[model samples]
Target: MTDTDLEIFAVAPPGLEPALLPEFRALGYKDARYGAGGVTMMGGWADVWRLNLELRGATKVLARIGSFRAMSLAGLDHRADEFPWDETFYSGTTVRVEATCKRSKIYHAGAAIERVERALLKAGMKPSADGEVTLKVRIEQNIVTLSVDTSGESLHKRGHKEAVGKAPMRENLAALFLRQAGYDGAEPVLDPMCGSGTFVIEAAEIAEGLQAGRSRRFAFETLASFDAVDYKALRRAVSVVKGPARFFGSDRDAGTLKGAVANADRAGLSAICDFQCKPLSELKRPDGAAGLVIVNPPYGGRIGDKKQLYALYASLGTAMKTQFSGWRVAIVTSEPGLAQATGLPLSQGPAIPHGGMKVWLFQTPPLK
Candidate 1:
């Protein structure tokens, strides 16, 4: 809320940096950098709204309100009050505060939240009785920083996949992996190991140019001074295109495939996607056009037994080599050894963090 352009922080699962960087760039955010769990870019309150409405791979977008040196509770209180809370939070709206302290005299996180809440109350806004609209605070190296979260829930909840199968990949991560696999609305795409069809669903959405944030509401809408006109205009400009970039998802589990079909239908993308029950060992190239094959196979620790998982990976590798020629391949796995067993000539892409495990995005060249 200061005269200076706001510093916005966007968080994602780690290895997704490569795929997410392009999305930031496409949004005209040039001065941005990646961090351990997310990306930071320079923008204003408007950018925060745009990001919440547009970014497909981002988990949460935070508006960096301010940062200042604070050594004690008094210093924290003064800094918290200095921010123009009235300009952001409305009198009727509810606000929740959370804090983290490191190596600071005001080490008590509860004390910091109380100070922040007092400041907001003084500006005429009440704290949420139910603890909603969370404001994330971090104090490190004696500097206190405050951020307003724009996405109330994580952006990965696309609201369509209600019945996910075992070891389901998140929609945000699936979109990032597909982009990292070079899916640019050109060729057909295949997710041979697609469990609940997240990858294929995302691919269909992207190919049709549908905005991922359209079906969801962002926390930014709760702000007192938020301009709805711009948001409405942006949404109006988003339209789905009809094209030939077919998306296909298959799984050995027929029940999961049925769930995938239901999910795709619920997403309004059944026309653009094909879901079927097919084992990886029996996967064959589609007859018409070349495409990219992306798979989020179950890593051993998460779902199936280790021996079965290793055999699955090996058989998947063999099937890809024999059947999916001239097609690009990308596999998301936490186990390097399992990825190595794929037998594809792979170079590590990016290291992303998901579900407390470090996931690697590995890519193999298009078959000759």
Candidate 2:
């Protein structure tokens, strides 16, 4: 493929590919479709930059540069040397190479990595364990696929949220979960167990039409293909439309609420986001039109005792039933029983891996 025509992959947490695809499609990637662990589409370097800046559900964006078949380490080195690395990477750029082999004659990943590193070094690149940019080599069935991690840090960082609470939901996953719950920034959003204000702040940012990567620097900036002038113009062209929906969050832990407020302020969403110290039992629907109530509660697996979490979840259910009429609800928890304890008419969604545990999103239609 030419420099202007390249394969772009948006990596997401396993099982969230479906949730991430619509985002690319909505952003004008008509050919975008879900893959095993993410979504893949064909575009140039500019698309790579835009995806890194705009995709909220992606954990990172990978640019599939090129690939070749290599049955042996010697062959791998030969092919790597033949490939045009100078086209995308600048000499002396610090990089780390990672490899995975499956059902391939080149079974040793270390050997494969060494071959690739040697080739890179021959091309004037510096190979370091602590490199800022990563090159992923996947050899499956004797076919090698080369991809660069265009996002240096995970996209979840968002370069904001200076503080985080215990077992906080990541920003990318929170955005995808909000989308899965049918939230589109058109209605108010409430998170009763808000920790660090990830959900509320993400919703507020989405409502304000803020760019996901506005505050961050991407790995693509170091690549030879990057265009600072073009990227700056792209960033400048994104205009924010202040949505009318208000985002609210509450938690019994006053200290956590304090941090959440700080996070909202850092995200520049404090104007539309309201944080308070309150328990689930004290949760009341906002005065505005009904919207979405999304929460990530303690499931015994991570934070609290299972037996006690059921009661907390039950209390959350009671609050929604009594006060949040016509508002949709989504609860993220590891235990199906904890979600069932909510006792709301819920639908269990695909299991998503989070913080060393598997969690599912349990949602409901508008509460009658």
Candidate 3:
């Protein structure tokens, strides 16, 4: 926190580690590499802000403030008191303390939380049962580590898309899927069953080079190291330019299409995005270079029986093969049988966990 060399952790969606690694390195963190659940990099508070603001694939950012060794509750209280509170937390701020302990003398997390809370209260910080600022205390093998959750809400919220269709894909996951599908922001993107427009909107943002967290607020603003003037300067340097390539999204439900349009408008991408009520059976190739088409169609238990969904997938496959010559396709679904029913030459994609269901992106070479 006070130190400019604190470790910053960027949480990535499971199965996208390789995709996230190159992103952090290209963002100038040479030390950025894959960690257990995310990518670990060395940076200060400003870097945390930058990651929260700009990184599209990271679902959350955690800043490791400091650490110590405490074998007993007395020892923990003593060490927590000496932490430089003035450098990280504002005085009189309400905060919540959450602790986890394993294989340590201070094995009781509740007792550990009480000790930390008492220390923070002694340092003029108020304790709130539920607070925006969270103090994560971890004790393992006689070592204690403390960190802060910089992103207020999950980064996937992205402060856009108020209307979400049933089983809507998270924004960050959509971005990673786009990258894995080989989208470089230079080509058109379409989603035949675009429920609330997550893929298409994410594509438009990537094409326009817009920051993912541009319209969002963060919990880091409540911390002591936050510099309002510096943050404003950082935002001033962000340039947004709409690209010429248009993104298209269509759904059979007119109400669903309306929600997609509203979400696009909120993201400031309505100008280059086209939405209409169209079913997969009638999906036609747009007049342009055949680009990538990514879709997360409804899969099992929520929409229809396996037999019915097979027909939908078959219709999608037939449409792509018949009309979309030279177009690449990515179909995300939880049912393998449905994917196979498409009848297109599909390569097995990595299995990504989505909404508690394991989904894979079945990709095809350009339709011949």
Q: What overall lDDT goes with each candidate model?
A: 0.81, 0.90, 0.87
lDDT, model 1: 0.81
lDDT of 1 by residue, 1-368 (tens): 44338888888866565568788888788778887678887777777887887788998998876678988899888887887776677775788888999988888999988998898888877786455577788999898887888888899987677769887899888888888788887788899988888888888888777777877788888886578886677773544444343888888999989999998877778777887798876787777777888888889767777667887888888888888889888888888889889888988865666777788888988876
**Higher-ranked by lDDT: 1 or 2:** 2
lDDT of 2 at 133: 90
Which residue runs does candidate 1 get wrong by more than 4 Å? 1-4, 237-245
The per-residue C-alpha lDDT of model 2 at residue 6 equals 94
Query: Which candidate comes out best when scored by TM-score?
Result: 2
Cα deviation at 51, candidate 2, in Å, is 0.2
Off by over 4 Å in 2: 1-4, 237-245
Tens digits of per-residue lDDT for model 2, 1-368: 56457989899989999999998988899998897989999899989998988899999999999988988888998999998888878999988999999999999999999999999999999999988799999999999999999999999999888888988999999999999999998889999999889999999888777889998899999999989998887784434334443999999999989999988777767768888898877787889789999999999876888988888888889999999999999999999998998789999999898888899999999999
Report the CA-based lDDT of candidate 2 relative to the real structure. 0.90
Q: Could you give me the TM-score of model 1 versus the true structure?
A: 0.92
| lDDT for 173 (candidate 3) | 90
Per-residue CA lDDT of model 3 for 1-368, tens digit only, reads 34458899889998887777877876788878896678998888888888898888888899988899998999998999998876788889888888999999999999999999998899999978787788889999989999898997889998877988887889999998898899988999989999999999999988887888988899899999899987876673435445454899999988878999999888888888999898887788899888999999888856667677888888898888898899999998898888898898989888887787789988988889
